[model samples]
Target: MKRLLKQSILVLAMAGMAGCTTLGPDYQPPEVDVPQQWQSSLTEASTVADREWWKLFQDPVLDELIQQALENNRDLRIAAARILEYAARVDIARAGLYPNLGYGADVARTQSSRNTLGAPPDGVGRVGSNYHAALSVGWELDFWGRIQRSTEAARANLLAEEYGRRALVLSLVSSVATAYIELLSLDRQLEIARDTLKRRAENVDLFRVQFEGGVVSELEVAQARAEYETTAILIPAIEQQISITEYNLSLLLGRNPGPVARHASIAQLVLPQVPGDIPSQVLLQRPDILQAEQDLVAANALIGVARAAYFPSISLTGLLGLASAQLSTLLEGASGIWNAGAALAGPIFSGGELDARLRVSEAVQQQLLQKYLVTIQRAFSEVDKALISSQKLREVLAASQRQVKALKDYNKYARERYDEGYVSYIEVLDAERRLFDAELEYTRRQGNSYVALVAIYRAMGGSWVDAAEAVADKVDFPPQDAPESRHWWEYPPATRPAAQNQP
Candidate 1:
């Protein structure tokens, strides 16, 4: 006992003093090459980005669809489940701060042969049984906070996963809005196609009559015929595209292909003005950036874990619970025994394995730091690029809308001239083609602008919460009444149809 106690004290002292010099170099976060200022229209900033910007677009159907996807998306569900798993791990880590206690008991009847080395008076020898049991307690001392550092790493990783999930939520919302907007654009373009086909049909009939009376040339008739068919052909192709887009949207809603409703045509819906929030806002609100930072913190903690590896470790193993061989005697007397011992251990002549491990950990941390910086650079680039793209696309769309207007006026004059016999049918056909082309270009631009807006919102990350309390409020859902209630399938039955006014 004396020797054991002396050895225990020596190991504890060694653990306290071991590795006075750490093997690995301290870690530092890598620097990123970032522009001092944004390269786009971010000079006029606003705090409105912190709100659910999608709702700002005022498409209730769209909001509901996104809510459903958030709850029903299989990937999101999987991510949420993983968070629970990590939470369980946190419980395990926190448990390490305390000891584990266990108890045991047993009962037995025995008999032995007479020929045994030390036989009893009866031939059957060594045939005696007694009741015995004990309780044990065990815990590893975290004198260097290895377990605590490790727990911190685990917690940061959990936060990273959560941020990843929120990024997905942001993406889903943006994608649904983009698809819905494009659908509206297609609807408008289809309307234009049908209208153009109507005028071309009338021109075709007029040219046929003139050809029969020998008033217009054969070439004129052929040109009108070609124009009519060319415009007619696009209708079917566009209808096909609309179908596919609808199917794509169904998949996003976690369902099979079906029609979706909305409140406005492409022309009626208000184009969202990009709130010129500064680039600095992105640093705090972007989910990917936060996730990257969390990963950096986790990597930093791992260095501590490895650094602690160079130090001696002390531990406690004790027996302190009730146990007995006889069920009746288990708790009848103070016979249930208890025992405890403190242990101390440290690296001795590990052939430099401990030192090598520390180097590897430091190297890993350095790589993570570099990656963290690169992630930030890329995030900033995306924000700047989205900002610029949104502005440029809106300008192009405005120009295209004006071009369509001009072409429409030109078509009116050309048609009147054909009626007065000032021009041949060919001129009218040419005017129709030009106007149709202009309308199509305008519709395409409209579609592209909506998609770019979605990209901008997603690039900025999910809703930016400026306060820790906001985060807590979002995450504090009671387990039984989890946020999963907002899933698509569980939408409020009393809510109005999302797109009743706009087919």
Candidate 2:
């Protein structure tokens, strides 16, 4: 019997090795077409985008705000929590690859009536006591690789969640920067409006004095008053917007509605030079794209797990124990008991449930494959759009600066001509109105330009928070120097190269 048990153990070991083969298609990333160069002809300078892109702005207030958002934002915290949850799931899936063991013990006493069977004349009842202790083990042989495939799927899911968290961080950084820029822009706008209103108020006084001196008509004074009131009205409107923007920014920082501190005005902020000559391949580093691919990987692995169900599932169970009627004999060799066995189960008929599951897994994998492709395409589109917006907005901002300069001179000359009685009050009014509009537009353009820059940084998958350092210490907001020119391929291999070039 001992020899038979050894032979059975050897057979099971051989069977396990034979069953180690994996089923279903191995994962291959779907191919995408990448452009060699962007359609727009932006300069091909080396991209410092890989560094914390926000550091390129060199603004201390913005740096601090982004850091706070990274630490305090609720959505970001949820994403981090999900990573832990998936990590635990990976552990659970991995546990299936090993045997489970348990220990148990029991002591019991029983009484039986003597008349129930072969009763003794002198005995009224019978009493017995029992003791038992056992160690039990069970394991399912992964001959069809179901457990391994499940583990693979879980690991891929964990990676996907990790990428998802990174993507959220990227988005959170962009959001905080965008909100901060808007706040500054609104502040600048409010300043311009107040300054224009002051000038209008002074002009109203000047027109009233001229009317009193019989040099100007009452109509002129009335028109000046109207202009002053119009400019005054803008103050409340802009102030309202500023309040709303601040509230929004506070939420981004995971704080209650309150004033946000700032040191730099919109004009004080300088736009960083665009990362010249970004290769089309850089979109692969985008966290969303990486996350999508990981999802696809998980889906693909599930297909194998589902396919594995079509084969027989083999399990081994064993129990070793001591059992005795008297507790004193429980540890003796004569009281020892043990049993071992194996089981094989296969679906003889399951109303097509197994087939349906396999189909479902395959369908899900195909869907994820499509989604992965879409993610890559969308990432490329965003980069293209950001590049175009940056280039065009730069031109617009330059024109706006020139327009503001020209209007400044025009307003001056118009006021002088009015003083010399060379032009009507209407001419002065026209110049002032035009100048006011141009100043607001210039401020708005500045803000838009900054916003576009933020968008580009987001599109490029730049990281402001260092993963390792973020965990160990408070984030530092040091200014970043431009990196040397390097090939885009030097970025991390989160994604594979596109199979075809864009036309």
Name the best candidate (by lDDT). 2
lDDT of 1 by residue, 391-490 (tens): 8888898899889898888889998997897986667667778888988889889888878877877776634422222322233322454554332212
Q: Which residue ranges in model 1 land beyond 4 Å of their true spot?
A: 1-36, 42-47, 121-126, 277-282, 321-336, 345-356, 462-503
* Residues 92-207, model 2: lDDT tens digits: 88897777878999999987666566654564447788999987777889987888889888877877876787787778888889989998999999999998888888988988
Least lDDT summed over 10 consecutive residues: which range in candidate 1? 487-496
lDDT score, candidate 1, position 91 = 62
Cα TM-score per model: 0.82, 0.89
lDDT of each: 0.69, 0.79
